[model samples]
Target chain A: MSQFFFFLTAIIAVAGAIGVVTLRNPFYSVLSLVCHLFALAGLFLLLQAEFVAFAQVVVYAGAVMVLYVFVVGYVGGDDETVHPWDGPAQKGIAFVFAGMLFLELCLAILGSGLKALDTRGAGFVPGFGSPGDIGELLLTKFLFAFEAASVLLLVAAVGAVVLARRRGGIHDEEQRLSFTEFMRPIGTGTTAEGVGTRDAGINLPAPAAPAAPRSDRETLPTGGERP
Target chain B: MNWFVVVSAMIFCIGGAGVITRRSPLVTLLCLELMLNAGNLALIAFSRMWGNEEGQIFAIIVMVVAACEVTVGLGVIVAMYRRRLPIDVDDMRELHG
Candidate 1:
């Protein structure tokens, strides 16, 4: 019974990892990551690290992934699958190096006396992995680091806000569109789109009105928006 | 538990390959999360072996750091995209000069 769950999560984790790297769509990649995290959390549960598993789901799969989905939308890939392979040569070298590392890890683990102890990995850690226990440790031993992490989050939040703020961007073209006496501002392309628009939030700079000369919008100096 | 450790190692390697070869920054970040989770898994397993919560504490700290990292990284990527810079990692050679 225990073995069944162990294999299930392990396989799912491995499959999700493969999906994350191999999937052509960024949205699907993020979704795969969610599955991967959940499976790993289940593995954590199997090891009886209940708090870590909860934290894994809440912090990683929940908050971090939501941020990822939002960013994927905000940073809008072209309305096409992003081919993640840089080149066969680069990918080949990367895989070769990773394979070497995996082999090294296997040798290290096997030689580190784990094999002598049989396949059983976890030792008895009575009441060690609970939230209360971890919380006490955080307050006592890791207090300083915990405080530092809070500060880090605050700084990071501020930095992200400053970085992502609009500055002389799509607003200019939209301003022209709104101010033009002749054309009505028909909401279509970039605005009022939902997440199901497929990893959406990639508002094309293409004007909604087809008849308008698109040369001006394309000529916007910095953002050479893909046509 | 040893099997879990081995799985974690496999995951870490897969993440490493993804980070190295992926063209999109978002996917690269996703791979980074994978690597971090692998390390966390190993740490938790070790915590069980050691019969202590120290490793779990350490994993929590790592998670916090990962969150901060992803936040800053995505911000930079979004900023770059907003600027209409080429999103490809190969094209981001301005740092070398």
Candidate 2:
């Protein structure tokens, strides 16, 4: 039963990895990565690394992939025109090298045999790789590195905010407006439009009338205003 | 037992191929995540083999580091995109000497 599950997990993982490399749409690739991460988490469970398995799901599948999707959506150029096989020669060379590396690793592992593995006695320890065990070690033996990781996370958050921040980005007042109100600026009684007025948060006057005729240029910019 | 090692190696190799051949920075980043995951799996396998909790703790640390990496990486990607930078690695000539 375990072997069957392992094979299933392995197949799903490999297929997902292939999809990640071969898929044209990055959004689809990100989805494939989620699938791959879940399969990896299953493999983690098979290895009895319970805590790592759950973290794999929560962090990689949940947080990281969401971040990828967010970038794909916000940046909005995920569909690259490059064909997967556009550089068949390069890909072929890469595949050949990678395959050779895999073959070498296999030969090494097979030659080493089970004797190479340092199995500590033939007894299964209950709660192995459990959260409790990991937490205890993290606070005790690995305390310094654990604290360092927290600090690293804080730094990363601050860095991401700084890096993605727009110069002269949405001002404090502009930040408060909904998308419709900001773009259309048809209300709020400021009665002015363009450069400085828009920045100052003055309410621009509503157009003379909804049915009033406007030139192509005025309507072109807004793509025809939404309600 | 041995199969775990084999699977991990295969995954690592595939990830390496993706990183090398894929032109998109996002795809490269995804492949890097795969490589990190492959290492984590091998570490866990060794942990189980040796009956030690240390490898598991190390795996958690690696995951934290990978998270930090992705955060910064995606931020840079977004920043680059905002500047209308091409997503292809070869097209980025800002560092050209």
Candidate 3:
């Protein structure tokens, strides 16, 4: 059963990855990426790394892929046209490099003689490496790095906001607002009847007469009106 | 079947080729991600064969880092797209010296 799962997960992962690369549409690329991530998480689970697997799903499949989708949506455009092949010279160079790397990797794998790592020992059991174990190790042995990662995430969040707020940016507001100011309630001025009445009063005078005629004129006036 | 390994390897090679040959930045990014995932498959296979936990750990780490990379990379791509409407790698010559 485990072997079946291993094969299943591997197939899913590889297929999804292929889809991600080969699909021309960015939306499909992101969708395949999510599929790949989830499959990888399943593979991790089969290997008894439950915590890591869940984190893979949460962080990669959940959060990061969403970020990719958001950026793709914001930069809405068709995929750029891709030339099928490179120039002969570039292709030759790439082929040579790829061949060399392939040879090197094959040689290394053959010569290393290291057997596949056996996990039939400590930390190999299902649910053995629980979230609590991870949390403990994160806070104890890897405390500094853990905190640093948090700081890094905070920095990334702020940086993303800043990057998303450049002049002529899609989300740039007319006024440059600080982070706190941006996050504050957008319309806190008034929510009561007074504000509603005030807004109506402000808009009333302009639409008091034949607003329909005005709009029609603005859109497409008759020949008489045009003259 | 060992054919699974062969299939995975072939997919990886194709993905690598796409990454190297594609001029579209988004396609390249997608191809790069595909290659990374191919690595994940091999790692998982090796872990299962050797019965070791290390390969799984490495695969998990790779996935995490890949996620981070894709996020930042897409963010950069979006920024570039805003500056230049198209997402072609050829037109992105702002850094060329």
Measured against the true structure, the TM-scores of the candidates, in listed sequence, are: 0.77, 0.78, 0.65
Chain B TM-score by candidate, in order shown: 0.95, 0.95, 0.86
Show pairs that collide, candidate 2: A190-A203, A191-A203, A191-A205
- DockQ for each candidate? 0.58, 0.58, 0.28
TM-scores of chain A across the candidates, in order, are: 0.67, 0.68, 0.63
C-alpha root-mean-square deviation, each candidate: 13.3, 10.0, 12.7
Give the per-residue lDDT digits (tens) of candidate 2, residues A17-114.
Answer: 88998887878888999999999999999888899999999988998899999888787745665655567788899999999999998888778766
Worst 10 residues of 2 chain A by lDDT: A208-217
What are the per-residue Cα lDDT tens digits for candidate 1 across A87-161? Answer: 577878999999999999988886798542354554565776888888999999999999999999999999988
lDDT of all predictions: 0.82, 0.81, 0.61
Q: What is the lDDT of residue B36 in candidate 3?
A: 77
Q: Compute the lDDT for candidate 3.
A: 0.61
Q: What stretches of model 2 exceed 4 Å from their correct place?
A: A83-86, A113-122, A169-227
How do the residues B1-97 of candidate 1 rate in per-residue lDDT, one tens digit apiece? 6687899999999999999878788898999999999999888888777667889889998999999999999988888887788777766878631
